[model samples]
Target: MAHLDTLDDEVPDISPYVTPISPTNRFYRIDTALTVPQVDPESWRLRITGLVDNPYELTYQDIRSMRLADYVITLSCVSNQVGGRLVGNAIWTGVPLYELLQRAGVQRGAQQIVGRSVDDFTAGFPTTLAYDGRNAILAIGMNNEPLPTRHGFPARIVVAGLYGYVSAVKWLEEIRLTTWDGFDGYWVPRGWSKQGPMKTQSRIDLPSHGSRVNSGETIPLAGIAWAPTRGIERVEVRIGNEDWTPCRLGQAAGNESWVQWHRDWTPSGGGRQQIQVRATDGSGHTQSGRTVPPRPNGAEGWHTISVDVR
Candidate 1:
């Protein structure tokens, strides 16, 4: 785990509203309040209320008694840079959120579920996605190990097909069914788009900047790409705006994580060169050409980097 520097060096040099980058290198923000004093599961309680036929609360042991399943999931932060460190893959173990909601009996006209975290952060998600068959889990374990403190220790929410901001609530405290008009989440109130969907993107990992390679030797270039809830169908690499060549993509582990890819490139001569990577999802949606910041929605565009071949 790496720590990131997200604090403003001085008090008033920049805009006050700028989102503080997290000290943890992980893409997601770590709630300072709740994370300070490690939350204990034995003393934890999850409350379900508002617009439900049966308003109730459950203790940690009560939730643990429910059926549990393990799933491999990938989480990506909406504010992550083009090749940022705000993404990770883990095996999560938890009960489906839909099953719990069913027991609570959602009332009619409920379009969203407002999720609250122990740190007072809130996220509003469409109720249909929360109740439908899609795997929306209240995760208790990650990577077959107890949830790491930085990744939401006691519990966190993991929903497919949505961006991390709305789906990955850490140190979950309560879930309340409500109408869309009833609430606005942290990001939504800050001018970010209400709806979030992960975009298809790829990155190169091997032959890092200033790497040296033999003039005529074949260098292996490897990386990963993702289209959450969908599989990656193909990956292509281009050199200097030339024709794109297909790279070999490894078999996908699951629908929610990234797919690894590798390609071989032989340097004709020793010089500086640029490489670009792009990917296509199972649905055949190509990556976007326009570049957009991660604030309003997810970032988009091909990832490119320059390297030197000696």
Candidate 2:
């Protein structure tokens, strides 16, 4: 077993799904490294090469010297199952990826942007995401603190809306521009798709499954929903056989971040009640009812939990 599972394997961890920003330590991590790569910030360099007219190397200082912006975005692992915890939101400080690509003078034939980590893990996405209004950055800081080594010490790649497998690469060392057929990421050969867009999803945190609660009192239920670039339009909750009811949403951080939502329900009859939650994305598409695993791309299905009401 991997040493840092905090339970079984480091591949999965409970996410700190708090609002606005989650505490850094509690933020979830998902990566392919068996051993964390230790890097010397002084000697570390980011190479922007391949299909660019101005290929160059950027030192850690050189990367951070650019005007950086703070982006509050949510990142989720491709392996995160429905209602799973391999997701987190944080404020990342970094330079716009397009800024770096602009400096490199992306060649006309470049279609893919491959981010390769020191450990040799690579993820490829469309090069257009950077200059075409998508939220893409080379992050140096997370939640106001220097990027923790556990999360990607000196730098990482972050592109909102896409699953981490396709968009987030930690301990990043190179940004290689290539064509669609130029390369396949590690996961792509493992059967996952080249593109891993996140599915609209929501989960109930309070009144956890199998917990007992007083029947007469109002059941204060709350959780989070995320749709990323499309943004969460709204969240709905269902109790027992009741129709879906709108949940009161907490302040929305941005279209790229998760939103908090809560609902207070008074059960007229007490027993074992089943609760389910779903979300609608800004595109007006509701979460799918079809249950799917996280292997090929991402998970889908309404998050369901059962609680015993006394």
Q: Compute each candidate's TM-score over C-alphas.
A: 0.87, 0.94
Please, what is the whole-model Cα lDDT of each candidate in the order they appear?
Answer: 0.74, 0.85
Candidate 1 minimal-lDDT segment of 10 residues = 14-23
**RMSD after CA superposition, every candidate:** 8.8, 6.3
Among the numbered candidates, top TM-score falls to 2
* Candidate 2 regions with alpha-carbon error over 4 angstroms: 1-16
- Can you write out model 2's per-residue Cα lDDT over 124-213, one digit (the tens) per residue? 999878877768999999988789998998999999989999879999999999999989987999899998888888888776789888
Candidate 1, residues 42-151, lDDT tens digits: the string is 88889988889998998878877888888766667788778665666556789988888888999998888878888888887898887555678988876666677677
